[model samples]
Target: MINLTGKVAVVTGASRGIGKTIAKKLHQAGADVVLVARNRELLEKNAADLGAAMVVSMDVSSADEVQAGFKEIIREKGNIDILVNNAGITRDNLLLRLKEEDIQQVLDVNLKSMFFTSKSVLKPMMKQRHGRIINITSVIGLMGNSGQSNYAASKAGIIGFTKSLAREIGSRNITVNAIAPGFIETEMTAELPETVQKEMAESIALGRFGSTEDVANAVLFLASDLAGYITGEVMNVTGGMYM
Candidate 1:
């Protein structure tokens, strides 16, 4: 078992689904978990249930709110040992029909939030000579999807961001990585049409949609002591969809 005692983690989008599970698992592994999301009620519910390390209500896309959120955490905990950039949304539209706002919103939440939150925690992380920054990317970013140009671009941008930041922080003993999860069974995946779901399943070498636990386990591994030497890598949790 990888030890995580005394570590502090900040998980964005922790109100539900994969992000929630990741937070729960990290807490189970002995890390103090800080939950971040815009849903105050749901965030508080999960935090209370897990006895969360901290809870902050803020939209990841807003720089001011993100900065203040981190300030609050810093005041209490003084450091963030792990950062999970998981808050994302899908505004699906083909380029021909996609509105400019749809593109911008998706980019801001999925890609720009990574920049906002990662930078917010960098100083604390660097001062300690340690950190784990994990970006939740997608297989669509690896293999483009129809009617999801905006989503694809955002996730791809995260891959680029992860690599560049890994290079910048590896010297500080910090590792930056990405986890690209394919076709996970969540409310989000349930929204896909039946035909599309069948097509997605058939395309995966594992012949199944993933569970929240599947992705959460990967995040735990990356955050644990076992992943200390792994950096600048995209850990595809996609069940061989892109490979």
Candidate 2:
């Protein structure tokens, strides 16, 4: 069994859906969880529900906010043992039809936020000689998707970032990795038409959409000591959807 007692875990974009579930799992594993999101109200509710130690309402894509937010977290929590970069936004459109603003927003939120958050936690993790950085990427990153060029590019960038950072900090005992999930049954996916959902599920080898618990369980494993030796890899929670 994996245990994370006494660890300080920071989960960004943790107000709802996959992010919230990840935070809940980490909290259940005995980590002193800190939830981050732009939605303060929702964040506060989750913090209360999970008894999280901290909640930072900030736009993670903004470098200044992220730096200040992490500084506050480190100051209050003492140190960060785990950082989950699960905060992402989708602006889906064909290349020709995509707006300039939409492209920029997706890149900033989905891709750039990881750079900010990851950089913020490195010092404390390095000093302690241990850390786990998990980036939530997607299968569209590996298998390109129609009408989602911007989103795909952002997720793919995260994969590269994960590998490079893992290699950079492995000597310091800080492990960086990415999880790519496909067709998970979240609030967003549930809104899709029944035909669309069926079609998507049929493509997966598992023949069903995964639950939030499925992705959260992966985060739990990666964050635990059980995965101490694992780093710089992309673990797919896609049920063989892209293979």
lDDT of 2 by residue, 115-176 (tens): 99999999999999999999999998999888889999999999999999999999999999
TM-score of each: 0.98, 0.97
Q: How well does candidate 1 score on lDDT at residue 8?
A: 93
Q: How many steric clashes does model 2 contain? A: 0
lDDT of 2 at 109: 96
- Candidate 2, residue 42: lDDT: 96
lDDT of 1 at 57: 95
Query: CA lDDT of each candidate?
Result: 0.93, 0.93
- Residue pairs clashing in model 1 are none
Show where candidate 1 strays beyond 4 Å.
none
When summed lDDT is taken over every stretch of 10 residues in candidate 1, the lowest stretch is: 47-56
Q: RMSD in angstroms, all models? A: 0.8, 1.0
